[model samples]
Target: MESNVSELVERLGSDEDAVRKMAVFKLQGSIGDPSFADIFIAEGGLARLRYLTLHASGNTLAYSLTSFARLLEVDKGWDIIDQEVIQRVVELIVTHPLVNILRGAMSILVSIVSHPYTGNNLSQGKDFGFPALKPAVAVYPQFLEMLVNRLSSADHALCANALQLINSLMRESIANESDMQWPKFIQKLQDLGVIRAVYSLMQETALQDHMHPLIEFQSLTKVLLRKWRGIPLDLENPEHRRALKGIHLASLHERRSQDICIGTGTGTPNSKKHNPMKWRRLGFETESPIMQFEHTGFLGMMDLADYVRNHQDEFQKMLLEQSGKSGHQCCPIARASLSVTLILYEHFEVDKSEMDDSKSYLLLESRSNLDKLFEPLILHWTRLHIAGLHAFFRLWKATGAESEDYERIVELVRILIESVVGGAVRTKDVQEVEEEMASFEYSRLRGLQMELLELTYEDVWGQHLMQMREELYHEALQFIKEQRIRCLLQGAWFPSETSLNLGLGYEKVSWTYAQLSHNRRYLHFGGFDAIKKGRPELDALPEKIDLSLVSSVVSNVSASNDPLLPNEKDIPPASYTKITIHGHLYPVSTTGDTQKNDGQNGTLSKSAQEVVLLSLHPPSPSVASEWLDGLLMLLNQQPITAKTNKLLNLVSNYGLKIRLLNVRFNDVAFTAEAPPVPPRDDLDNDYYYDVFGGT
Candidate 1:
């Protein structure tokens, strides 16, 4: 094998072109074997291959690049490849017209930038072998421009390769100190029209079928814009701001229309008119046929918000599909689109007082669309829920507390708090609960909660807070108690009984408290006003039922229909607020009942088996359904209803974090002095944190 490889290497210097091509082809095939590859490189094969890439053309050049890429896969290859060969490879990637040559060159470039030892060392400023190569590919302005230009290529394969190479370059750059090279690299790419070109590619109907690469490219562009350290365009400058707001350059026809005017002396339009100095003063040139800004960077020439608005339908569909998944299955396109939209909105829509009619209108339309898209899905999806809360906070700040939208946003926040608290009750695992409390979603939720508490300092929003004060306080208390209790269900309750004179009169109804233990061992009730006041003694609740004797739980109508009982019409048939528990009555005393039951060997006399009924009512239909499902789940019944099962799953998965969020909300909302805000989660270091900063 060694002798044969030596012969191939010798043929590369042959006089005939056919023999050299054949030799390169045979060498390309043998390079995959490690032993053969080492021998070929030792025999000066790498230098010869690099020479072929620059001097050869078509298949010969492509074959040489492919062989070079294969040699790069070996361990010793990077030690020998020089900076000139890498620079020539980048040139081939940009200048080559054929897809085959571009593809092979791109693969080689990706390998060089992605190699573990050399790539890592280069980014950290420690040179293993390729010191100059990093600047040749990543830092050089012309090289960055060449990569951005290939992004607009019509060939999908070439375009994808370009995107991959650019992404690799960014990854390498991010490892450096504060990504020091990123700002200049990103600025140069923007100057070369990369952002606009990428935006156009995303919207092209021809590229719709090949959108994975486009989506990744768009995502990378978003990251660069967000972390670029300084503003890319000056919003303080009127001309720059106007350009960012998407003022179109006037075409020659429009300029001509402005130039012509109807002369008062005649009933016909004049063929020519004096150039108006006013037009020039208004930033439109009268003498020049074209109108454009002095600074022509892409950031100044494009409206990112308008781009998002144009693709609103596509984004809506992606979000809808993603929100419907059972887990946090994020759609990269949707997340990237939303993140870019958010960054743009945060930067441009800062102060309403500074906005003109056009800017205000654009901001309002964008806000309205996002509100519609996120409102219905937030409660169902965790990531969208976080996003919805973020948008709501922005809306609240922009609209002020006096606007009607302010009240609506407050109501949404209140509902979200309740949902999160309710979900927290279902979590039982200590480790899982700890993990959730430490999550990114938890930090954001807590931040919003603190914001809401701050609103309580004002009279108008404080009234809304007062309305839910009792409820919020009660929930917070329950969350504290539930940490050790493992409560399955707990809420306000009303008990009703049959009367001899008045038929099923609820006129005597009084508010009471009820709780079902997680172990399904007992149902406890009593302490009404005390519990509402956030003070309750669980063991001293005054009434308890052994669930072992309970037979069934029912809703809506009465549990008994005997003639002696009150007529159904007398109570008007309790609908959404009704619950009935039926069980057998034991002859033993309520005290020491457990011991008495155990002495009876879990059996009861026939006379002691008489049916007993207990009727109760909750505050709402949803509460009644919750009680029904909790009871049914404890019974180990199969085929649970979908609605009940969904509620169960939500509580078990998201309940603990939400409860902690509510507790924090209440702590801030009720305190006299504002509490220190919780620290924001360190998202830059969390590997599981969403790229868009979701949970």
Candidate 2:
């Protein structure tokens, strides 16, 4: 264990910056004392963060820094700080070379303030001060004043995070000020122009966006103003109250205001459409909402081949990014991966009937092209990322959803796959390590292959496609347009058809994405395989590894009451065990609810909590009523025919009443519940989720 620890420490100190970046980012997943990992950012620690700010070329830097800024400071146990670096970071917040890094830094600062460690003594905010202070104030009063002022900088992009931090700090500071701290904390706040600073800043941002932070800040402002009346503050007003509410906090009120915000089409200047769906339904039965997509520009058959020809490194980087985007989809890199399987599928075995007529399609195996692709592929895997894959996948499918166009996706996935990932197969050249467990584990492979594909397809198009059925093939076309997935569609392999070739109950599609993200072999399984098909015995692994790690993972997974590789057709165990994630609670859904058919659609939807988040979090009824109404409708609907109904009742039925609860784990599709139809409506479902806690 000591040797392994030393190796980890050394890996944190790897000379290769890429290695160092990965170490820093992956450190967030450390199983041990996460606080210990922060020491790496110290003087003796890895200073890779410095390079990330300047080197914006490689997206690895952007991801690492962004991840660090997001997760690190939130860990209250991790109180590590380098004031000098922080000073630089704050200074660079507005002028950073990279927009992402700046956003990340701001997020980290907010997370830091959110931790329990925040206080007047240990922290600083708007400096309203009688210098005659007590030792309890660890942070100087003036520092607090500066922070408060900075927080209210009025530049939404600039001061949003700082503003939030200051607001929380003020809330705590005002409520907690005493003789033990600065003398007259409240009086000092009044004296130090806190109202002026905040009000001025609010005016500046009033004309801009509500990135949700505005609502939070407004609440804090209201709290402060209520205490200090005659400050030109009145929450009694609807706008004032509405602005104080979070996007989802207080749904009903928000809806009324949201309705006002969305005018009742008066024609000329003001009579306009808010959501495209309104115009869509009014315009045509299948008309779509206006959508803005970030296209990568590689479209059509020629564009597909040309994209393959020129941007091999870029493509591979994308694959690597996607392969490990979420913990669930982290697969093993083997000799034969998705690309290899694609080749095999094309050469050795071709399902002619599945092929669609295309203008031009051919195999791509030129040594030069592969060689160029190899460099990016290597670079991508070396870092392990996701931002790049979305870009790459979009580019690869820029043409029609032709099977031939998706050849690259299939090939690369096939080539890197370790073994029977999802249902796809891949082999590692293991002459020397035949008796050793050297390759990446199945958990990793299955997590990426089965999980993500299942998730992406299902969430993006599957549920709506299945429920709406053949009549909705045009809907698929619409979704493709709205989602812009059609722009990336490969015409031959996975092209747009006017029909559903396979029977896709919501469950299969959800699981397929789950399989793709993690279990790569899912494609080969055909969704019809029975459970408990064949439990592979614990055999000699391909590498000498820690058995305890494997044991811990299995224990954790089983502890959730998730099945232990059950037969394909077997009903999963009804687990009394409940797991929580991100404050979202997940209880096992019983078969009665899991299989319940709601509506004529036969769609199984999410539970009440899934439908109504405002039950725990007051609905921001003022922000948008349509989202709330849609949610309420989904919530009220019984498990008679809808996907969400079955899902909600599956956990714990509420006698057809709407009751929403919050849990640490919001993604419950994998929690031993029979997976329902894919959540096509992003508002209602999920195909898969990144398992956060377990390593």
Candidate 3:
């Protein structure tokens, strides 16, 4: 097979076009196999293919591009492709006249820039070996502009391809904000007028007729607008100043005034000059109302908030109509449009006084749309439910305490919360419920609930609502805690350390299941077989440690310095966590026999002060770090406050570390030096309180 792949590679240098084309096709077929791919690349197949893409014409050109696309589909194939090759491909996409050639070129670009994996792997606390590649085509100066221009293409397929390519580039750029290229890439997209183009395309009757592409464009445009949303208006920049002026003008146009006739006590006409005397009149007097209007002048210069506001009715009608559509066919488009609407509402600063007059309209429309979302049938879809939840929060915040519909909004929120948590609790008996809880849908729901709780805690009305439904609120919190723990336990395998004296004659190393007891006061561990057989009894376990007796939990140890347990190469050093327990020791037999002797029984012994070190190896560093934080929480005996629970939940959900700074509660404080805490969307900026600090 290697010889066959090598022979085809050598044929790429043939003088006959037909022979080279056939060789490229054959190589494309063979490159799917990693071994064959290595042989082809070793024979300089990449360089040969690049040459054909640039110099060859017609069938050879198209075939070579298709082959490159196929090669990129292989695992880690982007590592072998160079930036120069990516640039040439972009050039072909721009200059090539053939649609097939253009399609093939776009496919290669998509393969290069798309995320390497699917779903929220990072949120799940898992790591992929391959980092997502940056959108190399952004380096080509005209590629983004070309893509924007292609949005108006007569060919639907070409336009769809352009949207996909643009979406992939934007997604990759946004996902890796640390990359220096993101700002420049975003500015380039904005400068090309991509957002306006997308909005215009969305309004087109033709595009709206096709559901999939319209949703894609809507989602892409929403992402593009994110960087510009809520950005402080720079009065120094003429464009920003103009945007402000346009907003003022639009407000004036929407404003209304009325004059009322009033009877005067004196029968005399009022003078227009100052210090005029009032006159009494038996009849009524008429007065002219002041009115003002100005030209908005070039909608392109206006900010997105004002732009959406200018067409508020049109956008509202469109979104409301789209939200009304039912079935799987329309769910995605509805979700995308709702997300876009959410961003617009957020930017509109709906909580401020300026939006007070329009609050009724916003609330009424949001409530009506939410009626569809809260339906028993529609609530089953998690994505749609999330969108509805977000929209509900925004409307609830905007409505404040003044609207007549405030109570109704509160009722809808309760329903949404119950719908999310109750559904999960009811599914606990299902076989796949554990897997379902670990899914991205539930993770997103959990994060949303945390944000809701925080919002409720801060607002006066929200506080009242919480008091009214305190039980439901606590249930929501418990649901979050359980789901977080479940996610942490997924794929977590702790191997017992060899150095510990388990009364076994020989060193024993095996996988064990570790979990918090039913009341969460004790940590228990038993053989993996018991857990696999669906019986994980805490009291029946051979080894149980009271969390209150735990002194400290240390991780990332290469070797144990304790004189009692010698350092050994029984487990990987990076994943090891050394747990120090004081006061009592519970030693269990390492043998597989289930018979419990008095010494091996899971019982607390009344012994003198003793320090025992137990080392465990988790699946990864993040998991080890999570276990460390959880144990520290237990050791401190700190009650789980809303803030602390949120922090722990963040650690479990996003795999971030909680660096306990100064934590103060009831005039007591605990401080620790650790790495800087990662920024979270839900945290307040006034002070970065330690998550371990009890509220």
Candidate 4:
């Protein structure tokens, strides 16, 4: 039946315009999940989508049509609109002819799925295979085929979005009513060939084996097969009753079906069949299988002999170790017999007796008593006892629920991780780490602790912490800059429009602050004026202000060599006055906008320079006294080159650039510095140059 629909869809692509529309209309109206737009994009997708969108009467058909390029452009109004329909119809539109007809598919999906307004109320009482609000189920086989076929296409978001849609479609049914009709779905699933397809997909590496449900599928199959024995395969037919004989595997040839279809990646997923699972029944214990062990008599006798041989020495050691011991201290010979006193609690410990006494005759008869007898063995082999508690802690974090004890442990773990990872503590974990201080060796745990914490963070905490760290740095920089601004005021300073980034009224205030500060040493007025008027003898000054601490990385820039040489006075100061500070220069004109102060070229662009707050001047003394007392608040932020950079590399967080730009200095002694030069323009106007790829 579905084959006819497939054949018609292929015909629509090559058929006459009128015939194409009819075929498309039927498919779109029937199955709203138009995923074929991906295929059309594969070769001459652009041309095809253009044809579809221009001819379309409305966005109805084009809405479902989307390719990776225009996925995010999808809108809500067009979301329910079947895209393939629109694609076929759009060939008629003359304007925007090249526009991908599949455009806005993502926008449509995101808008409808995440809409705060009309979303939830509109999606109700719809049955398309999976009880999902998804319109894809009516053509589930087609949708699945499209997805599997498009797996190799360059677009990842396409697959992601498709999966998201499928999950959304199946979400409610699988979660709420899984138990009610799961088995029946499984039955229908086998009949429609989904089980065989899924099994084949499971075997293929292309399917995500690590997906959360894949493990559950394997477990479910084992349980189902175990329960199949003695249970009738079909309750209605007497001849259908048969005991399970082999592993519960799905296969095209293995299934008992009326019309057996060959397995392909795409199989019908549509089924209103009630789930076979009983949620309330809970676990494999609900239905135990009747196993027919032909060699059970021989195996049981062999197991007794093997067990005696393996444990003969272990029993002797226990007798010698506990020659006179008794009670809880008897070295627990019951299960696995290993016990350790709880270090922190002093008295409360893992109750071994609980394991031994936990056995129940019916449901708990098999696996239950083994825990008691092998408790020591598990502790030795699995580290199960302590690990179980930590696992509980992890669950607490994941679920967003916390008890006082869990919360306290979390806080402690956070502190320990922060101190170590931030490099506050240097020594690696060479010693055992204690939870409390004094007993806690900060340095010893710092190295080992971060490694442990890294694993914890890789899951959930790391991503969250990284986001929080960025926010904190921005905040910290703001506070530091505010203090830097306070120091930027004093006695004398040069005004560089392009130099210090003072915008609006802030620059004037900063100028005023620099002019009136009490401690001075804020702002520079060098280059032209720094040269002694008539004396060449006193004009001598050092070359580079080599403050090694100013930066750690090798740079082309050296500290300012202020005041032009006595010989350089012969050169006239141009329209712009520039003073090189740190490694860069600050420039401002009595004219327009400024640009980056390149070494040879000082050409100022009108847009490059901006204004700083017209902040008040700091306290003044007019000499290097203030500088001697306190260091100039210089901002030297290099790109994130280390792991630390991983947390702070954002365009919004680029504070170092801003800090380096806004510097203030008073007239200070200089050796010999050249006056500012005209900036050379770049040959290529289209090319953009940036240090960190513009972050």
Candidate 5:
């Protein structure tokens, strides 16, 4: 065997191309045998393979990668490699046009990354056999970009390979047990769009099969949730740095103890601290799979995994519904749909021990005699968990309880509502309701509230339920109020529209309702029309004011009481107020229509380029301060970037071109003038000459 391996290695350097190909092919065949692998590496086979990777093409390049990657089975192989070699391999995997070569390169990466020692050394902040692979942070950007690109491939094998590669990368990175690198890895995934791209895989039909890809997806998600649940490290802050260092030292000591021989260890004073295996469990005693699943909400993920494995048709329908019928109840199929949702929430950390209590608490709260009938299923249902809550509600509704159970059911419903509202905490784990999950949460909560209202409508003992409903309403109202105030204080108000005018009272238009909203590029005030026309519709379309055109938002102003209109210089003191936008001053006053602006009324000129003042009168001085502060905060947003302005300008020109084409096609008016451009300091710049691809 030794003589044969030597002959093969020597042929790899043959003068003829055919001999070289046969020699490389034979070496590839010997890579699986550890003895043959050892001999090949010991005889400087790696240097020759590395040379081929740099200079060879096509099948020769593929065979070289295959033989070289398999030889990395030994620790001695990692010792001899460098960053240039690893980078060359990754570049080949990323840039190679042929699918077979890409697959071969990806397989090599998956094998080496799966090795336990690779992860162990990387996590300890030691060399990963190469400088590029050492930090992980430095090379992750390119690595993640290439991985995300492959996820969009239509070929099943290619997509599976990409998913498996991602799974291996995350597993090795997380296994390092080092707290400092953990959060950084997760953050990099987020920054480079890899996390979001991976999430898009949930909708992919081909990748959801009961294969290695699915298992890898589930495991990668679990590791992500665990990292999110842990405290973040801030190296800039001294106190945070100290905490991270303490955690690092503790983890290091734990790793060392696990390596020590068992029972040979002394019954030391710090036995608990020294026993790394014991501390690793973090108080989770049993080795039961269910208990293990409970820690990471893995059970919910398993439920989803089962659905994807055994019920492909049902899963496809659920995906379609999530895309088209978002915010509507998942009726008729609510049970099946909620099962998948349960998995998503579990993986996302919406269901946790801290927020959830046992179902025994629910049983103790209910006083109905019919409780025995529901007890069996109720026992299996988890409370304060979103999926369990929705499932139990649907089941109870479907069961058609007796009339006597109404009061008790109403009480239970009250308990559910309060639990959901009270349990809401500022957690990164509880994912915000996106377009898909919208119907699963708030809408269901509203349904529960309505159920309570209907049950308590007219019964003698219903007074308590009615009061609870009222309290819940007030709680909801207060929540919205607080959220609004918080948005105001935080300066992150959602872009919105409001009715307004210039407050300069015109003859035909005593009041004009206008809409307002702000984006990064401009402060827009549009939707202008007459108030007395009684239609409550805008007479003219809205327009946007570029932020670059505006100077400031101010309140100190004097205005004229002219009914027709007033110029900026004609306004007098004490009888009027106004706001200045883009050097255009318009008077402000309360509108007579008490229904709008919280009963505060006024209107100025409805003409273009005028400041539209919002007349809001709160019920109290504090409310007034909140309204003012919120407005000021919204107005104080940072200046728009040049890139954003350029985009807005291009979009504006495209719309103009579209409207011009429409007019020409209809022959409505070939002479119709284009709308005047808004005044801007940078309007003279050549920013939009390429709107039609190019001039």
Candidate 6:
């Protein structure tokens, strides 16, 4: 371990920046291991790392800080980080010019502030002990103020990092809401201009094609929404009250005046002139009353009806242009506009108790717009996100049964839920194959007549095709409810979809898991062989090699999860697992299995399988283990034979298989009289045959 620490320290001093970054990254992961941590500190490796954090240049400096933060993540690891190092990290945040370095510094500060030191009773005393964590609390107010100021940085990345740090700090405060101190902490954040900064970020990036800023903007706004929901608005404090009402004050005052005019069918009296004010127009214009009089908030939240009223032409033009844009089917702008239209239609009120006899021209027009958006939005349904769906649900519940498009919208939603996923085998590929092989029909005479008629018609007639709808609103509602519960449990709001195929040559076939059977050559996904009707193993692999494999599944090491940076060879469209059959490796691609039935056409459809053989690169470690297990089970379940015993012993000797009830130590252990090695010539011949598919 000391030798390893020395090697790492030498790498950090090397001329190659990448080598130095890798050295720091490896040190971070090793810090969790007590042995490695002890060796690092004992060899003065920790002191070397501290010097690098303060003096290193470029990527090396960023990496050093990141590793330093990870070192402090472990419990009692705080003892290793002193007040000077903590102050240095804060200084980096305040003074670093490079975005990457600032991001690293921000990460380290976030770790320091977020560390759980409240309950620990260390050797120093009963209440607090760790000086590195203790000083952070004292300086937090100043540190947070600095971050809030950084929110206006010219660099988008720097601003985003600062926002992320503030968000993390806010999340902790929200989590400890039971403590009354959290409310004051939240108010202090507001006072520091955090909310305004978030709003400015959103407004700036609302229409950009870049996704990172938009994602960051959404995260910051979400934190504000949580604060709005958790704590009541402090109307007593003038600044706090103004901050809460700032975004919608003009609209709120207008709505209040409109409410008075709508109530008596006349405007309030003009007191200065001592004359009664006359009403201009009723609530039943082409705009809905909800859109006209919504008071609390509008910028961050969805208020489609109101938006359309304010900028009707621009909004409609945006929708039309985005819907027609080529490339991605779910155009962001188009989907957002359509989703808002649906929301407005779902919430429009035709008859309120206050306006029992009033005409609902506004609602009637809104429902008509809904009729247009419902079909178009469904055509690009994949573009809509879960948040949009939640908005739709809220609007539906608010509308109740009064909407003219209520039944129609419900039917459309049911069709969307069923048709978006699965139902049956798509015979389209098979049909195309058949069509090419079969004889062509005689359309020569009809084609000529149609050609002449087309010339006379001046334009080709076209029709929009849509999936047939079913009245399964109740089922769709139940599904939405279940999704809500799932979101609550998982803390993940987006629904995962099956990934597209990567087109892996001949191995592009979709493979599924089949049930273990007594007689089957190939274990197909259907649980039974349609042709062979017998269990079968891979012919490509040697029979002896197949018998020695074990099977286990694990998550693929994604770029983020991987300790080292990714290279060109490491990138792929899908996750993979690798299995070692004998000594040869094979890769298997894996993903979630999504199956559903199309209620409209009454068809059962299935896409690709959850697991498939890649036959390209090495599979993930988990896939390799699973394959090994399956191979072992296949051999163990067979009738006892010399070949089976030899294969099992080979695998067991390698420590690949789990120990069975009976100990076969004599068989599994390596002995002096092992199998004789093959000659070089024979080994070369076998390798050539395996590569070229020879006997």
Model 6, span 1-695: residue lDDT tens: 68888898788777777887889878766776776776666777776788788778787887787677666655424554566677677777756678778877876766665666554434544322223433654765476678888888887766766876676666566556465465567668778886666645544422232123334334333444334433333446564445434422232223332222212332243323311211111112122222322322322123333343454454334333433322222123222333443432333221122233113223433422322211212211212323234333433333332224344334433333222312212212323322321222223322333344434433433221011011123333333333222221221111011212334323223222222222422222221112233433333212221211223222222222212213324323223332222221222224422344677888645543333221221223323223333333444432122333344444333221122113365433343466685567635443443221223
TM-scores for every predicted model: 0.36, 0.23, 0.34, 0.20, 0.36, 0.31
User: Compared with the true structure, what per-residue lDDT tens digits does model 3 show for residues 297-387?
Assistant: 1111232334335455543333334332322212122122233334333432323342342353355444234222111211122233333
Q: After TM-score superposition, what is the CA distance of residue 657 in candidate 3 from its true location, in Å?
A: 52
Q: Model 2, which residues run further than 4 Å from truth?
A: 1-8, 28-64, 70-79, 117-163, 169-212, 230-695
Question: Against the hidden true structure, what lDDT does model 3 obtain?
Answer: 0.49
Alpha-carbon lDDT, every model: 0.50, 0.33, 0.49, 0.32, 0.45, 0.42
Q: Which stretches of candidate 5 lie over 4 Å from their true place?
A: 42-44, 73-76, 111-126, 129-141, 177-181, 199-202, 208-210, 232-695
Global fold similarity of model 5 (TM-score): 0.36
Write the residue-wise lDDT of candidate 5 on 339-385 in tens digits: 33333344334333421323333443333322221111111112224
Stretches of candidate 1 off by over 4 Å are: 116-142, 196-695
In candidate 1, which residue pairs get closer than 3 Å at backbone N, Cα or C atoms, i.e. clash? 423-655, 424-655, 424-656
Off by over 4 Å in 3: 75-84, 115-142, 145-160, 176-246, 249-695
Superposition TM-score, candidate 1 onto the true structure? 0.36
**Candidate 4: 10-residue stretch with minimal lDDT:** 337-346
Answer with 5 or 6, whichever has the higher lDDT.
Answer: 5
Rank candidates, lDDT, best first. Answer: 1, 3, 5, 6, 2, 4
Distance from true location, Cα of 433 in model 4, Å = 32
Q: List model 4 lDDT by residue over 40-111, tens digit each.
A: 333333443345544443443443243222332322123323434322222222122222332234223433
> Could you tell which candidate, 3 or 6, scores higher by lDDT?
3
* lDDT score for residue 648 of model 2: 35
Clashes of each: 3, 140, 6, 86, 13, 31
